[model samples]
Target: MDRSEYLVHLGNLEFFHVKTGCCDADLPAQYFCITMFQIIVEGGRNMLKTIHSTVLSADVEDTGLNLAFCFTPECGDYEHEECVNQPNQEETSLDENLLMEEHWRKEESMHI
Candidate 1:
């Protein structure tokens, strides 16, 4: 597995956005419906050392519906099969300029 980067956004909000050396993506929908998530992944040939997950809130646990079905996984190995290793995962990436722009956009969104 090679390094992979992803930008998981929900409408105007981003939930999971980061870069990982070992590619893996199969996030469950339950991770977004709430303001907190307790994820547990198992059976990994290479144990996941760093796992980062975040859930935001609009006004105190509005609803636990978890509208997070939309998912996009980024993989550098475009030619190598199993991009995200998941049947539902997709390949994607944000360039440096796009990433910089997103950084400012994310910062601004956080302030509002």
Candidate 2:
């Protein structure tokens, strides 16, 4: 993929560096490098599975990238930090969380 298109896809993935209302120019080159690694490296599926597990195990309140909140357009800003910190009305239910995980698994399979 070209740079702009790559960024758009990475942006959709809701990484902290790309989703924090930061402009594309503001992102560090390392983020792009990591993404490229994920896309191009053989056996990257294991790496991504580990990352996904780590994110799920992490304290969502402390970390900025709460998977439950990550996919929404409304989450593309610092305001998402507040949602992560506070008990928001839009918090995902247990079933919803399961659904989201299943959806992500499907998406990951498609990409692979």
**Candidate 1 local lDDT, 24-82, one digit each (tens):** 23322222222211234567543222244333222213344333323344423232455
- Tell me the TM-score of model 2: 0.24
Clashes of 1: 1
Please state the error at residue 31 of candidate 1 in Å: 26
What's the distance in Å from true for residue 9, model 2? 30
Q: How much is 27 displaced in model 1, in angstroms? A: 32
Highest lDDT against the true fold, candidate: 1
Q: Give the Å shift of residue 60 in candidate 1.
A: 43
Off by over 4 Å in 1: 1-84, 100-112
Query: Relative to the true structure, how large is the alpha-carbon lDDT of every model?
Result: 0.37, 0.33
